[model samples]
Target: MAKTQEFKATERIEAPQGGPGRGAMGGGMVGQKAMEFVPSGKRLAARLRPDRGKAVLVVLLGVVSVALMSVGPRILGHATDIVFNGFIGKQIPPGTPESEWPQAVQGMDVVPGQGVDFDAVAHVLMIVLAIYVGASVLGWLQGFILNTVVQNTVRTLRQDVEDKINRLPLGYFDRSPRGELLSRVTNDIDNVSTTLQQTMSQLLTSVMTVFAVLAMMFWISPLLALVALVTVPMSLLVTAQIMKRSQGQFVAQWRRTGALNAHVEESFSGHALVKVFGRQEEVEAKFAEENDELAKVSFGAQFVSGLIMPSMMFIGNLNYVLVAVIGALRVANGQLSLGEVQAFIQYSRQFTQPLTQIASMVNLLQSGVASAERVFELLDADEEPVDATGAAAPGRRGEVAFEHVSFRYDEDRPLITDLSLVARPGQTVAIVGPTGSGKTTLVNLVMRFYDIDAGRITLDGVDITAMPRAALRSQVGMVLQDTWLFAGTIRDNIAYGRPGATEDEILAAARATFVDRFVHSLPDGYDSLIDEEGSNLSAGERQLITIARAFLTDPALLILDEATSSVDTRTELLLQHAMAALRTDRTSFVIAHRLSTIRDADLILVMEEGAIVEQGTHEELLAASGAYARLYQSQFTAAAVGEEV
Candidate 1:
């Protein structure tokens, strides 16, 4: 039977302190904060290090594109100068280029009687258009390269997560919530992907644009450029303040999202149980509470980050007005041309545009960093111990022994100590125990699901730990109390036991386990489809399929842990006969609550509190009249009283 461990509600719902969800929504102690922003951001960036070559290429493209776009305003300013000079110079005498004109036209290049240089202006406009087109083309190419890099990086991250899941010890799954783990794998990774896709290209372009446009601004008019630079500090102050306030909320939002997803998954998976217990209102109330918390944090994050762009724009407009006034005065004093002033004003707008963009991207960057930290935590978890090098392989004779083995799930609480047992070749050993008596745990040790802390377990006198886990487990087959079936045809599910089994072998195993009795009656025989949940099959039918699956492995040893507990009396009797045949010439460990099922076994072990209290044939154990005798008598009395009622 599967052993159930007791845990507090809080333990199931929350991660350990200082883990991924240590923020406000994670139910940490008061005053605890999420992970620091800079470290998490740096860790996220490290994931992209493998693609640094591509990243550098993307940066180059962005710089070149911004450079091309920045010169357009200067070219357009030249066209403006041509028109202004022509208007002022029309009143001068013909061919009077002798620098004797009025102050407005003194420094201007004007031709007498020339109303306006339409041809020159058109030529300049065309050059500006070509520059913009080149910039657009480079921008598109940069986006394409960046998309490839981001997608490849995220793909590698997903594969790493998948591999890590396999390496994690089974105990990790026992302590962690299924929904929370799923949220990390699916929701958090996806958030990271989206964040990278949306922000990477834009951020690169925005920062480059800031530098390129600022340089152009200084080239056009240093005084106006300085005036524009004044707003830089104010923009930085606003962004820093807002980002500081919103960073925690962004972390809290993702954590709350995970918690809510966990609750929803648990409720739905146990929907029938919740209805049986009449806890629908309580479940809904909890859902509402979590949903409300998620909404509040999400709102706070968006609202705070949303303040950045407007503040930047406000500061930018002030800079623009100040520049326009000063440049106009400079033009009037003949210190700068009207065209230069026009170009400087345009450069000022371009400069602030990128700052606003950077401000707007703060929310995405923060959220992405939060999710990336969660993923990193999963990757950094301690994995199961590595397999021994040059490992031995177990012999197929099926002789198993535990020599003074000691094991415990926790350091301070010992479960099994100084336990020793032997199962000889081809013998059926039945283990009878109450819940938490270490029956299943003993089987787990035999399979090396959890390693023993002291002493050695051997198969055919070869230490199991010395053998690779695959080699050791290949010799054994297990049938658990829970029956799991994926979405596939019945034949496919049966063949999963031994992937390359022939049709005849599948049929033989099915007949031996009595799965063939009902399989042939279905509409498609072995080809009938089963849903992911296997809801179409009865409980007994599901157990029969699992038994057939175990039979197909043709293993040297078999474990049946409450395998027939779900079947009815008639089906149980049939399975007992089938199992008796399957156990021939193979060592078998049968864990059962029903004494009648193991009466004919070669050996029976009565275990209590992780130690064997009695061992003998059923008749011999009954003759001793010990703990086994009391348990049998109590069960017999209860059955007799129930029949009388």
Candidate 2:
């Protein structure tokens, strides 16, 4: 009968957006400067250290393949010379050797009266083909090995991230958005995988090809090789300038991506609430703003990085023109053979092609490193204090005592101070107060979700801190106001309380908590599949299932925080009866705002502003005419007025 609170339309929505006390926005990297390339690149490279042997083999195969392919053009050039020599010889005097020919033909290896040697050309072509075929086979083998190494490295990285998430403290999660954390784990890690997969083999091959082709170029003609080398500095200048401009844009692009994902996730999770409050337009407007920001940064990053390829191509063309004119002049002066000139031209093309490939791969490397930095940040976060080694075992008798405990979420604002209480075995202690009265915090301390700042808490005369967290928690059972059920069958959800519970034990717990009343009516009975959100079940039905889960644990201590607040009157009454049966031989802590539910509690403690104000049985507190009497009278008068109306 208490007055129900109405939510105003102007109330601020609790969407997971950027603000103070919520940690950094945009996957915890917003407003921070872009990370330096060298350190991040090195750290990313460290992830590949485990597979270094396979990586070395990949590099060796690439080098061997490039070496074989580099020799093809020079060998093929010999065939060209043979044909040219034979044609000249056929036009000369009969039966005359090349030494007796004119000065222009004297240097050519040709015999008079001989036509083109088709058999010699065929033999050269076959050798070149065989070299190319060997190179191709080696390339394929290296690709296969490189792929395996990359996938294994990524798998190990994913496992590290998963383990890191478990080690972080509850306070870290309270300050971070769920969506942002998920983005770091899923989106960032996936981008890292793709970047490594696409860039590793190609980058290695291109670099090796560049060196191999350069050595061949100099071996053919040093002067022409130097002319081709003129473009190397120019290409590097262009690459450095463009990459410097695009690096920050790439960082912004990924940061905005995380923010956009966070907004969308929060909006979808609370879509019903948003629609009920008529805030769809506001949500859409915010989405549009973030989407526009992401698009703008993406465009800038791509546009700047796109200049590398065209710029490299232009310089390469200039180098090619210089090499061709010089080589033709050298050939006309009889300083080089026509075949050598042709081979040099092919080598020029090969040289510039690898440079172009290297320039293009820079963009992918930058983006990958950016994502790796974000993932490394998650792995470097401060974790919870390590559990005690060889800690003492907890007693099964649930006698909990809090002695002068003091705690605070923030250093400047004190929450619970000098709080002391004791709950003997087989007792029911009810806590009653208004909102922000530290009722939930009390139980949370008992569960050790957040360690206290000072003083000690104990179970069965042993300090809770002296026992391992898992050992201490194993003897306690808790039921929160919000119900959580994974996507699984009803029987599976119930069995989650005890992993190896028998079918008979599960049925017994379900029947004891009245969950069988509705579950039996479903077509699949206990085998019915529940979606992740459990939308298939009603509110009361879900609560009943959670209660049944707690019952199956059969713990010595139980904590129920507003467990009946969301159910209807009939359902609440049924739950109260079931809870009574469950608490027959266990110590139970109940936190409630509806005073009627705690009338029969052995001890009722009234709290105000994080301090205990009064304590006694319900009738005794009412007789004393204190804070408890005021709260009861107001509710009783409101109920009577509603009945009269």
Candidate 3:
């Protein structure tokens, strides 16, 4: 059997301490301040290297389109001059007064009776129409190509993040909230995707239009161009100030969004618990607080970024007034033509528009980069170390031994120290311990979820450290207390571990685990659909499916970590029976809180504060009357009292 590559499913902790976008939305994260990180534009750009050729093509199309757009007003101005000269100037006498003559002929070339050239003017208009149409076509092409590139890039980015999540060490997940990691993949990557889709082509077009308009304005008249240039610095100054104030807010917005997602996820997942405890009002209040914070940050970001448009318009209008006054004076002085002044005014308006658009996109770009930074941070996380280069272990016979193992989740507070045990083939070793007594830690070490700090673990006399994780895990099967079922049919969920299992094998495993009883009664039989996390099914039902899943694999070694803790007495009895049959001929390690359930174990190890304090059969431990005996007596007495009541 090939081991599953996906990590074990577990809900993330609430309010994880740190990840990308830390201290992004407001002060700190999870009620504590976290260090902030803003990704560089150049860094985000580097991700596009693979699509450089297509990106360049899109930019080139944008430039051509803007060039065509720029020439339209100039050609139209020429046509206006032609029409004015052909008809209006025929009446201006050659000896007209110099001051009056300027007004009459300022926009006309006077060749007395160059009468209206209707054909020439119509021809120029037609060429201008053609240019506009061509530019529109180029614009559409650029947008289409860019969309393809952007979507493909985003798709690849999401895949990389998924692969990274699988490779990351379990310790990373232990410290971070699942919601926050989810935000990185879903929200953060989506932010980047939005920027690429909406802003990339627009940014390119705006930049090209600005430069193209400037060049056309200078060609029309340098004097008017100079007047228009005065507004450029003022516009830039306003944009820069607003951008500076809004940068942090944009970063904060995404952070708040992630926090809000985490809160909503946690509340919904624990909704039953909240209702049972009558904390609905409290949960709503918390949701409101997070929602309000997110709204405030988002509003600040948008409001500040929004100021660029009206501010640029004001600068544009002011520049227009100056150009009109000066161009008219120059026209009256016979130094500039009316047609040139009109074209220059159009160019100035065009210039201001692109500046405004670029200013507006600043928010999107910053938000995207912030989100990209978060995603990159996950991609750069420390992954689990590869297995040591040594000979692969022979197919495991489940002869497991831990040699002087010592470990801790945190270095300062050790959880397990110098623990040693041996489970012979076909031996069913049961572990019992009080809460936080390291019962689960023993199984975790054996599976190498977190490698031991010191000493070695072996399977069938072969060092496990040398075996690839996938290979080692393939030989072992785990059924945890929390049953995880993905969105699929019941049959598929059961056949997850052994994907190639036939219908016969699946039905046999289900029968052995007693899942067939329920499947046979359901409307869809084995084909019933399981919703996300299997919320549609009862707790016992989900556990039964997981048990059948483990059974289908027929693993050489089995680990059951409190697999029946959440069920009722009847379900527990049924599960225990199924477990007894499944454990036959296989080395098994079982951790349980109900001591009675494990009374038939070949061996029982009682743990306390990370060390084994007792080891023996149930009768043997009772005769010794030590910690195990006391624990059993207390449980037995409680059961007797409940029965009497």
Candidate 4:
């Protein structure tokens, strides 16, 4: 069996917390309801700005759509008036309507007990049909307008979300889990679109619909209308109470969902490592725990939100019975017409219909709000700005000097302190140290990846802090310890440094680095796809490709941080050749722990902790019998006596 490779213990990194202010929805249920759809004002602005022209149209259409829908009850009330007028002319009683029914319908073939006027009945029927047709057409128009509104609004929101992600700072990605971020950007945003796009429009229409129906009902009979209106607040109070209770559940649901997604992404991203470690069962248990918690929260949120519709209907139905009884008594005393009583019932139903819809929308509104807040948090994260004033492009000499530089990744933990070094033009400087020493930190200073908390760095006798970062970086080439290659053809990666380079220049760079020989050995040469991170190729091959890229750039300064540490002796020799070829006319800085690697360097600096402890030529350092001498005597003295060392 092969040995299992164990990684260094996983270290936890805490990202700063962010979101919006608390809303009026009541406590942690705000988080707990069903999601943490924390709405952010800035995120909303960003989302609206991209397709602002279309968003304006969508909001306008939504307004017009609601306005149109609000007219339905009014039209129905008009039909009721027409019915009332016919009943008045016929004088039909509730129980003795059969003989008089024909009288109401033009008095045709009057039976013994049918009291309705036949002609009157016909008139009411025609009026009802006309009202129905008019209402239907208006409803269809409202739907047409809102369909454009919803679809366009969603498209605009999604595009902005994607754009925000692309423009976000690299540091934002370092702390955030990829799956959680992905969930908010793609999955959560999709839910927000579905949840609120229609609800927002309907919330307006629901208010209007309820008012229009109430006004008509009051006109018919204020006493009965007042009775119906009482139940409305009751419905609202009930909905508000449920919404309050459900907030925490929703927040918990989103939190659990994010955790679940994080687990899935981690499991998938490290599938090979997991298989090698035989951690499948352990991973499965963790995933199941997260998923189970998510399901619970989801169910709790849904269960509470689901109560609103049915409760609303029950309250409205109870009010309906009360209105009917009271309306019949008013009619018996000749204070109400039969049509007026019928219209009252219709208005009552209309009032509750919108109430039910609005209740449903509140849940989704909170969810969208939660999601919006997270999106805005990312946009608001602080980013390093491009140096503006007193900043110029890097000059040709590339004389990099770190003067009394000190740095710490955190406020309390200093990694490099009061360290000073210089790299001259056309010279090769190598940094060596024990593991966890500040060897790599020196190279990082040259690139200005993290600015020194104290002291300053300069290039060509100019302060680097005063130089435009883009211009400074343009002249420097870097080969990182972690190799990251995009999923593109080999030629594309090589040409990434100089997009407009001629074929001859690319071939020259490849040949100089001995990359062309290996590339030509492949089936497709430079056109072959390497997939993500060059997984199809050997580690050394990927390093060679990156070396070709650096050569293509022809940067004035080059940095190789443990550049060939992973390769075998044979490949290391080829790398040495590649490095020697590239360093002939440019300044270079190499970071390695190996003692033999620094033998050809123009200058060597050995670090301990965050301080440079020794500096000199290889033979001088060996003669001094210090830290460098000890390191060399332990590892390289025997090799240098005879071989390629």
Each prediction's TM-score versus the true structure: 0.93, 0.91, 0.90, 0.81
lDDT of each: 0.85, 0.85, 0.81, 0.70
* Whole-model alpha-carbon lDDT for candidate 4: 0.70
Question: Across residues 1-645, which tens digit of lDDT does each residue of candidate 1 receive?
Answer: 222222221112244332111122222211124467899888888888888999899999998999999998999899999989878767777877656777766766777767787899899999999999999999999999999999999999999999999998765665556677888899999999999999999999999999999889888788788889999999998899999888878777877787788779778988999999999999999899889988998999899999988999899899989999999898888889989889888888889898889889998999998888778878887788888999888888898898999988768878789998899999999999787788888898998878889999989999988998888888999998888887999999988889999999999999988899999899999999998778999988898898899999999999999999999999899889989988998899999998888999898989888888899999999999998788788889999999999
Better of 3 and 4 by TM-score: 3
Model 3 residue runs over 4 Å out of place are 1-38, 94-108, 388-394, 567-577
User: In model 4, which runs have C-alpha deviations exceeding 4 angstroms?
Assistant: 1-170, 633-645
The candidate scoring highest on TM-score is: 1
Ranking by lDDT: 1, 2, 3, 4
Q: What lDDT, from 0 to 1, does candidate 2 have? A: 0.85
Q: Which segments of candidate 2 are over 4 A away from where they belong?
A: 1-34, 91-113, 623-626, 633-645
CA shift at 532, candidate 1, in angstroms? 2.0
Pairs clashing in candidate 3? 24-252, 25-252, 28-33
How many clashes would you count in candidate 4? 56
Per residue, candidate 3 scores C-alpha lDDT tens digits across 126-232 of 99999999999999999999898888888888999999989976667665555666787899999899988888888989999998999998888887888889888
